[model samples]
Target: MSTGKVVLGTVAGLAVGGILGILFAPEKGSVTRQQILDKGNDYADDLKSKYNGIAETLKEKFQAVKNDAENIAQSGKAKFDEVKNEINRPAANY
Candidate 1:
């Protein structure tokens, strides 16, 4: 699934679990709230790290493809120039 869908699912699951815990627990409201906040922060950090890694990989792939296209264009131009020069050369007299 896409990153957005994964993130949404994670958030939804966390919310549901937190609600269940608060409903069933004998702990104070403040303590449960703090726990949920801490867990959510950790999950956010994990997702951020994953996103950065994916972005870096995509950038490298893009650069490689761009370089290959440039090289191909240069090769084509060189061949065209060589053919043009050959055609423009003086013809031999009989």
Candidate 2:
């Protein structure tokens, strides 16, 4: 499997396991519920941070790729124009 899918699956599994553990603990109902809430919040924040970082990285990479493609296209156009000019130049007869 791809690394991204693996990471996502692992995170999901951990979250589910945490919730189940809290639910089955010997603590009082109110305490268990509170613990589950707190853990859920923590996991959500962690996932959000990871997701934001990944998104920012991808955004930056996309911009870089776009700029490179633009530069290449411009370079090719300039070369094409140069060749066309050479072909159209008037040549003196011998």
Candidate 3:
């Protein structure tokens, strides 16, 4: 149902269909085997590239969230410290 799933299904279907077509075509056994091997390698490389891209995007998103959390924590701590200091001050200092 998701876009990623649809795309993956479509790609898988296309690869399977292409390999089947090549298998059924009239050709020398060696040639047919070579073609299948070439196609498989190409598909593997493409999948690896896509995986790396997705991994990089996830890493960037994770880093951004981590930075935001750190900033929020620092801000909260600074406010707490300021309040504590104020509370401990002498009434004459107010």
Q: Model 2: runs farther than 4 Å from truth? A: 91-94
Computed on alpha carbons, the lDDT of every model, listed in order, comes to 0.82, 0.92, 0.91
Who is ahead in TM-score, 1 or 3?
3
As a TM-score, model 1 comes out at: 0.71
- Candidate 1 local distance difference test against the native: 0.82
In model 2, the Cα lDDT at residue 78 comes to 100
Residue-pair clashes per candidate: 0, 0, 0
Q: Write the per-residue lDDT of candidate 1 for residues 8-55, one digit (tens) a residue.
A: 788778767876876678878898787778777877787789789889
Runs of candidate 1 with Cα error greater than 4 angstroms are 1-23, 90-94
Which pairs clash (backbone N, Cα, C closer than 3 Å) in model 1? none
Worst 10-residue lDDT window, candidate 2: 85-94
lDDT at position 12, candidate 1: 74
Give me the overall lDDT of model 3: 0.91
The C-alpha RMSD in Å for every predicted model, in order, reads 3.2, 2.1, 1.8
- Model 2: lDDT to the true structure: 0.92
